[model samples]
Target: MTRRYCSLPRQSVPAFTPGLAAERLGALIGGRRMWVNGTVLHYCFLEADTDASVIPVPGTGETRRVPWAGAREQLDVVRECFREWQDLGIGVTFAEVSDRCEAELRIGFQLGDGSWSEVGRDALSVGAGERTMNLGWDLTEPGGRWTALHEIGHALGMRHEHQSPFAGVHWDDEAVYADLAGPPNHWSRDRTDASVLRKLDPAEANGSVWDPQSVMQFPFGPGLILEPEQYHNGLYPPGSLSPADKEFVLRWYPPADVPAPLVPFRSAPLGLGPGEQADFTVAPLETRVYRVGTFGESDCVVVVFEERGGEPRYLAGHDDGGTPHNTGLRVRLVKGRRYFVRVRLHSTWGSGETAVMCW
Candidate 1:
């Protein structure tokens, strides 16, 4: 018998504006959201001895463990990919079980939360120093390595590569994601909310160009599998990490403090003298950018600077939690000749009315 799959509703195209350069820039810079500190993650692994037609997961329950032969090999592959981050002085350790550590990362076989598709469930769960990752067994099938890598990227707080600045080059949303998979299933208000937060979080980087070969990217579409230039019989072959991917891993996950260029922007500022704060706006000239959270959330802020003659110059500084309806910056300016000032805003999943001040 032929298997049947549920088809999702079509998505509406984002209306394109003619000359909203800042909006465009915001989209670009916003694509590279960062993770936050004191953020913990949990991952669960499920194994089935017999290659069952499907895997099962409880919709709401503590993580469980199963047995499978491919678990170690799969873990090794993930470790190899993550080694790059480790080298970058980023801390990523593994624990035996969910309770063993404050944060958990789960992996398993099959698809769905036993109700719908596995990928459809929340891929990452964020809590106070705790988050969770669910890696389904379906990803262990032959040729599913790319999916494995992509999900791991999410576990590491990385967003979809298609959301990257270089997304224009690789993304053919209509063709590639025509039959998209998993929950947060289609782009809805909830999905948009998550995307907005992921984009602005300070732990994410800003101004970094999207690396097409980053393991975080999907390998089945456009330049990824089928290069626009090298069309092979109207079909594109699967793609993997390029030299750049290896380099990024090595550099990002350095064993020590990697002497990398300073990220061009800043998060919202803090510790303002009573009644003294900075105000700004969210404007992306040619890139997608976000404002880090301040006030009620994390304490970090983001700022952007321009070079003036020989010294770096400040353009703007933003404060957190002024108001949500307005994305403009609001802070007290001190007696100083700053180059310029602007503010950016980002949204979090459960936290309401958070702000990040940036210049």
Candidate 2:
């Protein structure tokens, strides 16, 4: 399918209702905490008495200091925020790492200017297995607290909340684009501003339809300065979370599943070189546990193939129980070598763990 993109501006406050519900469900499923697989976070500490508004950027390899009280307060709030997710089954926690921190699972913090933007340069450097959140020195200042939360969301690997699928309901694409374009980062591309809209995983498409009220969502614009109608419920700030957004986060990434593994178990290839042909088979560890068939009649297996890079190519296979209990597939590989395969065991309950194989 062709990738669909949406044009929307980022919001300051992310929607929270959907996330709340997802947390509830996760707790019921497995007693284990949901893990956020990839992320590396860092924070800068400041003194409580220091002026956060005029904070200066920290020099490289230097730790800007924050008032003991201020740092403690911010950390407390942050800890509490993550605790909420943890309670829901998401496994979000904090750790202390110095410069030795690496990408796999390392994060560090430094105290410096929050307004200068540059001070938090690597603040968004989260990768697989690591995520980062920043605590600006001026967080105690008015509006600064919200900024800290917004940045933290990013540190948690969430794109602007406004990018939620439901954003199309409230956003006036042309108007918002006119205002957001022509900056250090132009919001021209449909996918540029709306990170939530992007397809991070195929499951998201099947799960909740779409929601705009997720706490991970961004507001129409900063609280003031730009009072777009979407910001409020026709006339006032619409504070309630959207059903879809709330359901999405809460259901997908519950607090109990903090540090959850967000890896793609099953993946299709992008492109394959011309005249190339590949075939493979996988046997279920326990065959009797899973029966394959449309409606309990005959046994069968399903195979799916897709081209990744050059052009979109796909195929599927169904094998009768006669063939050594294994299903096979063959495809004509195209130039550019971008292709992958995925296998599914369709049963009465539901599909699980799409076994992915590539060549």
Candidate 3:
């Protein structure tokens, strides 16, 4: 069979507006619509300040229940994406299993419109009827296929490529605001800032360099970018995953390696207060990005260290990340080394809880 490439127009393409979809699902500036544990959590609120009034759930609120018939067709596409991940050694699986079976993640359309998936392991937080992924729209073409792969990328713990702090793409902010606020996406200033202008922190930087052609990246169209001749006109249609996409999956989800923890090392719901810190130890393992985040309203700072002779040696530290200032760090730990993780409160808030995770 011949392949159909994603040919979303440079402007006014609704299907290409995944960020807008996320905004519609109640993800405010710097706040995640979905939460991460060892799996994705959909139809559930993770942060304290999240607005629950608009969340779509069956027989609740004013939103329509998911049309499972349509959802099943989309599941076929999701399975294809899963197969690709499995082929690349990422140990994730997607299928229509019995509701009684204990599964890591459950995806459906019990939420707001468009295609969206919780980042990585946040999916484990929902109930059977609730969805960890939503296909508010239908999957009818090759673009649907690309959408499936892009969302599954999130399911695999990868973030938006354009948000990479190192991408360095000079966005024409005013033009971006103007363009996105009209036509298909009538995003507000805060949503625009969070979705388009917000850059991932240096600590969240993964892979070697930015992959503009990555499926996780949204094409900016003409006049949206102002730097790097390679990106001034926006990227060509991301019909499929770039080489780096595959490499990232293989590197993070090596089949031979033991699976990382399914749950967080700690769940600090109240958060660390002023001058407060928490410590944890890591086992011997190759270097990879470990995430530390506030489930509540506190800003967080994380420091990684190696214990030596009744002392501590610093290895890595990060303050803000994602659009919300969550923290992430990539570090290498020795097998028997006792590592101390110091989680500190960075906001004026008195106290906030945190969750530390590795995968």
> Top TM-score: which candidate number?
3
Off by over 4 Å in 2: 1-73, 91-137, 142-152, 155-157, 177-207, 221-250, 253-359
Q: What is the TM-score of each candidate against the true structure?
A: 0.41, 0.37, 0.53
The local distance difference test score of model 2 is: 0.33
Can you write out model 3's per-residue Cα lDDT over 1-359, one digit (the tens) per residue? 22222211111111222343332222222222121111211122111222122435557556632343344566667677667756665423333334422334455443234456666534444454444555545565646777777776776666777778888888889988887777455567776776568786553444559887787777667777898776777665565888898877654443332222223354534333432344455554544445544454444556665666544444666655323446677766665566656554434332434565543
lDDT of 3 at 202: 51
On residues 119-189, what C-alpha lDDT tens digit does candidate 2 reach at each position? 11133233423223334344455444444444444444344444333334444445555544544224454
Candidate 2's clash total is 84
Candidate number achieving the greatest lDDT relative to the actual structure: 3
Q: What order do candidates take by lDDT, descending?
A: 3, 1, 2
Deviation in Å, model 3, residue 203 alpha carbon: 2.4
lDDT of 1: 0.35
